[model samples]
Target: MRRPHGVLRTADVEHGHDLLPPTPPTTVGVIEAVATGSPRRVVDQRANAARVADLFADPAQRQRIPRIYQKTRIDTRHLAIDPLEPEFLEFSRKPATIRERMNLFFEHAVPLAVDVARRAVENLADPAEEIGQLIFVTSTGFIAPGVDVAVVKQLALSPTVNRMIVNFMGCAAAMNGIRTAVDYVRAHPDKKSMVLCIEVSSVNAVFDDDVNDVITHSLFGDGCGAVVIGANQVHQPLAAGSVVIRDSFSHLFDDAEDGIVLGVKDTAITCELATSLPDYIYQGVDPVVSQVLARNGLDKAAVDLWAIHPGGPRIIEESARSLGIPPEAAAPSWDVLAEHGNMLSVSLIFVLERMIRDTRSAAPISTGVAFSFAPGVTLEGIVFDVIRS
Candidate 1:
């Protein structure tokens, strides 16, 4: 395949080694900095449940709502809309059409994306114009010229910066985006790149008595996360405790495409969660993690930390059990879940940011693995090490 116009080929740079195979790039990608942005409104589970309870007229369902919300173990979430507001309550009862939902998405998603991207860039040692690639990931919204373009224009990123948009991949999109960044930096070690994940689940809210809808509503919150990555060759002396992406792994559970369904309907965006998803995650995480570790000549015990996506309380617990790690090892995932709920593709990045900060004072070298699940019952894993400066 032809390289893009400005991306240099090794052959072009090494004048005397024409007959030899190209050497590997001498730099690894480092996660320079990470930043997160949330909607201004903080929605407490009790008030959220109370507002949701009004939507279900049945006394029995109303009684079940609070119990279901409590079971999620999410105390508060950052929602783009206030659940207790009369206007939002009215909209929940009479759901908006798909067009209206998309409008809500456009109005809120771009500004959040730009804000998070700005923060991530601010943490970088390089200027904003030095960012050569921009990847925007979201499962909750779509637009032509999309959030990527808005981010570029708003952040004053290079006009010629490479751009990618990953849409509708659900929770796993963030890992995939990071992997894409790793690939980019490995190929173009001189360039810096960024991955921005923003999900406005509140805009796609589904108000229904269905248990799946109730669980989905209880678990997701609106938020955006951004990570700035660049080859170590370009950004030497990145912030202390910056993580280097060592390797990545991905797997799709056989015949499990229907495990989590996210689609759009005339009434609103729709989400259907399978009851067996926790079981799927429990059975699959071990193999994906084992293979990645084994390939890297390490094992589970060698890892100092884990950034398991907090898809839900059960998902986190079962994943820890499968990995044979103590519950506290997955505490970052649990804490993020309780504070922010699931922000879809953005949740794992939030966990990553927290782990990097909390472990800043640890030993000189710390190994960590991150995992995220999406609609395919897919698992995306990354092996990384934090090196203190």
Candidate 2:
């Protein structure tokens, strides 16, 4: 069966009243710079691929699991906490509770987010000044004031700086955060806005025998990605080769919400990576891409870069095939996934940082498209016009 490319089937939209709603384009802001940081602890799956499989001790259950972790294409990932640390080794006697896990999130997320944010703003003329707004995005853990407060306090940002948190929005949350930052910059053109996507997927790991839990465990690592967006004409101009927000769009999968699940359990968060996830990405990519491009008055040929989220290998593969994006266009995303696993809410921003920082991308890269999927069975797309320095 051949899947339709570059067009949304009418059938999918009929079931949902709000499949795609185009938002009026926001004022353009330059993506001054991009940066991403990890927790300094690295794990090479290649070395431990077999040993980690031992996490699943039931032989009958183990036989059904693929030792390759589905050939995740992931080579190495960094974690805030080494899963095999002596303390965690006695898991049966004392598995980590949600409270203990959140404690780790607060400890690790702040410095990681602050470092990436400082790196982004360091590109400015004065360096790290003039940032008046902070938008923090993460899905793995929760704190009352949110990590945004921590980012500001550590950076010594102006106490009056506006703060907003995009919580539990999953992988694509960064793109949504970027959109909101664009709105903030547009509304307050004199100010600079910083967006941080910090995901501590390492701490979210559950020590369980469930096959789904095992699969999810193999695909997560801890990391933070940040970008600074400012008015093009501001005192500290965006660095050259910065991506400008051309437009943004949001869409849903009609009835595919069940395909990706992240739910809160009594003592921990549980996730179910349903088999149809690839299908959900496949079905949603065309419409989301088509509509976003169309609304921006862009054609398929305009995009020289594709910043699609690397949710998984299959998600990336099916997306490129469906959207007619060249294999090379998705390589950064593949590399990020292979190197970082999926950092939950922080994953897509890492993809964007790769696109922005690639020296090969050079300058005057006119147009680009970024796509990411979330548990809404939601898809958000952002179109960018890269201005060379």
Candidate 3:
């Protein structure tokens, strides 16, 4: 007699029983596609160093410019405004006010966002109507209705699209945006969501003699990146080269509140980065990652790709060493830093895009983890499996 449905026979179990076939890993959602864009102007490190040197009248601050910038390991960056332009020069000579900077942000942020958003949604089954939610993340600037409203208008996104703007979260904001998107798509598996990260760091330039100001000026660049996320159902199969997001982890370190501070000064936004920030990350990363892997029933050996944020040279280096990730696994982070400087929250998406694209030609990255740091000395990560086919 045949075994009953949903039942297994004792003799079959005692013998070699192939009761059921293996099932695919369940996922919150898949990263369907990614698109990135930058402003027209390109600023190489040498030119940027000269520009920084020009802003400082003090001998001490001016002397530290080269070494500080060189240590950042950035080669070229894109900026919204040309440093030599009259408006930029005027602002540098006499720093732009908060109002002026916000105006610049409003101008550049929307267009860049629209461009990348359009590219991101082009391959969707219904580019305009399919997106059920829009999550926008930015740290450099903000507006009343913000970039999300403009994106809906410009990209012709669904008028009723649910919108959330993640502002002032600093470098690790993208993970928050992705987390939000994942939650939405998982709940509404039939609809898709988008995470847009735009940082026009140039608009927040601080032309001051302070060493922290110089360090901030040297490391950041302008960029916009977007990722479309959706469920892996038959009606909306995972995109080619897409990665199925398995799980995410977020942690906030105690007594590290001041590790990174973004102050809204009268002149413009100012950033204070603690010298010990890397040490905090080094000590904190292992546990956060181990927890992420453990929850997913995995370990370091199971992770084949790592997409750690390049906060600067040291942040990425320390993060990799702490996680026991090989140098080559961290190369994409360093490459993005060198090519685009640190685009704040937008940078990690670039690293993810690079890794996903690289899989096309070379060996596919099967399992991967992406993580980043933020102001609260916060650590965020996502575990995923590459769908190379």
lDDT at position 235, candidate 1: 38
Number of the candidate with higher TM-score, 2 or 3: 3
Q: TM per model?
A: 0.89, 0.87, 0.89
Compared with the true structure, what per-residue lDDT tens digits does model 3 show for residues 1-389?
77565466787678767556545444468898899999988888977787778767888777778888889889998999864566775776574388888888989999999999999999877867789999999988977777889899988777889989898888889999998998898778888999999999888776546667677878889999999998776334555588788888889998888888888877787678888888888888998899889978999988878898977888898898788776567888999999899898999999999888874444444788998888898998789877665
Q: 1-389, model 2: which lDDT tens digit per residue?
A: 78654355677568663466645443577787788899898988766555556666778666555564657878888999876554764542254477777777888888888888878787566433588788888888887776788777777788888888887778888888888998888888888988888888777666555666667777888898888887654334455667888778888788887877887755566667778888888777886788778866787887888887887888888888788776667887898998999887778778877666666655456578887887878888789876555
Q: Which ten contiguous residues of candidate 2 have the minimum total lDDT?
A: 87-96
User: Model 1: per-residue lDDT, tens digit, 83-126?
Assistant: 44677656765744677777788889988888888889985565
For model 3, what is the alpha-carbon lDDT of residue 17? 70
Query: In model 3, how large is the Cα lDDT of residue 94?
Result: 71
Q: What residue runs in model 3 are displaced by over 4 Å at the alpha carbon? A: 1-27, 58-60, 83-86, 92-96, 234-237, 360-365
Give the least accurate 10-residue stretch of model 1, judged by summed lDDT.
Answer: 16-25
Identify the superior model by TM-score, candidate 1 or candidate 3: 1
Q: By summed lDDT, which 10 consecutive residues of candidate 3 come out lowest?
A: 18-27
Error of 2 at 105 (Å): 0.9
Q: List the residue pairs that clash in candidate 1.
A: none
TM-score attained by model 2: 0.87
- Ranking, lDDT, top scorer first: 3, 1, 2
Query: Residue 25's C-alpha lDDT in candidate 1?
Result: 50
